[model samples]
Target: MNVGIVAAGPVHDIPDLKKVNHIDYWIGVDEGANVLYESGIQADLLTGDFDSIEPNRLESIKQNTKAINQFSSIKDETDLELAFLEAIKLKPTTVYIYGATGGRLDHAWVNVQLLTMFAEKHLDAWMVNSQNEMTVKYPGKYELNKDLSYPYISFLPLSEVVNGLTLQGFRYTLEDQDINQGSSLTISNEWSEKKGTYFFNSGILLVIKSRD
Candidate 1:
């Protein structure tokens, strides 16, 4: 299964819901349901405390969705977490998350951490917005297509250290370089050739590719 989760962030920054053609399931987090409804997309499940949505809207959502998992406002996990757990339970081949960025810094950071959690489970996931796509990767070789149109590429170490970092077809190549977390060594590298490749031997890294 391939699932898509919509969070209650900036709806305008999200890609057009109509463009997503192969979503097996749709999940709405809180007021995100309203965004989906406005975009003429139906949700398979809805999860959140309904704090951000008006009572009438929430009632309409409850009537429209197949399943609703309402939680207390003082729950332990965030709405995104709850939606992620449900998506994982479905064992999806890929989980595409929208409306996860361009909001509060704390929420954005937490959403990034959620990507790490999916990576730890050996799942393919991405936090995608209008301008950028973000994902975490374990130490390994990664090949990126040249025609993707993302102008800038960045690799950020998620652990204290990422060892044996190497890059090919990039403006700034690093061969067997060790990058420490919080270091600005791996930032804003563009492809110098047709294809770009990155490899690492240890630690997790967050790869971000952006168009603008």
Candidate 2:
């Protein structure tokens, strides 16, 4: 099953939920419930502290949502983390996260780090917004198709180094290279054909598909 998690970020940064395919369940976090409800998508579960959400909206969400998992405002987990824990119970194949980026810098960066947990679980997880789709991958071979909506692709090392990095069918290709953290060597690449491939022998890689 595929699941989507929507968090409280800039409303405009959230993609049109209806347009994403194969989303079997939707999890709304905090004010994201209002965004989902306003977008005409009822959430399967709502998990958050409710501090950022208006009381009236929370009431409406409670009425329409399938279930609720409310947390204390003083809890250890952030609202999004709570929502993610809820999502894990469903055993989804892939998780698409919306409204997670374009917020406070710290929140956004931490959310990016959260993708590593998904990677550890061997589940596909993406942090998506209007102009970007981000994911983390382990050492392996992977393929990508050209996406007109997100015309650029990038890879960065999440670890100190990603060894034996290679690229095929990309405008700026590499072969058997080592990319260190903080290196801008793999930024802003484009597909040279209908599809492209990337591979690395070791370390975690941060991949981003984006547009201007």
Candidate of highest lDDT: 2
Question: Taking the tens digit of each residue's C-alpha lDDT, what string does model 1 give over 1-212?
Answer: 88999999888789998888879899999888888887778899999998999898778777888888999999889999999999989988989999999879899998998887788777888888998888898878888766466788899998889999999998899999999999998888888888889999999989888886
Cα misplacement distance, residue 148 of candidate 1 (Å)? 3.0
Query: Scored by Cα lDDT, where does model 2 land?
Result: 0.90
Candidate 2 local lDDT, 42-129, one digit each (tens): 8999988878777887898789999889888897778988787777778889899999999699999999988887888777899999
- Candidate 1: residue 1 Cα off by (Å): 2.8
What's the TM-score of each model vs. the native? 0.91, 0.95
Superposition TM-score, candidate 2 onto the true structure: 0.95
The RMSD (Cα, Å) of candidate 2 is 1.3
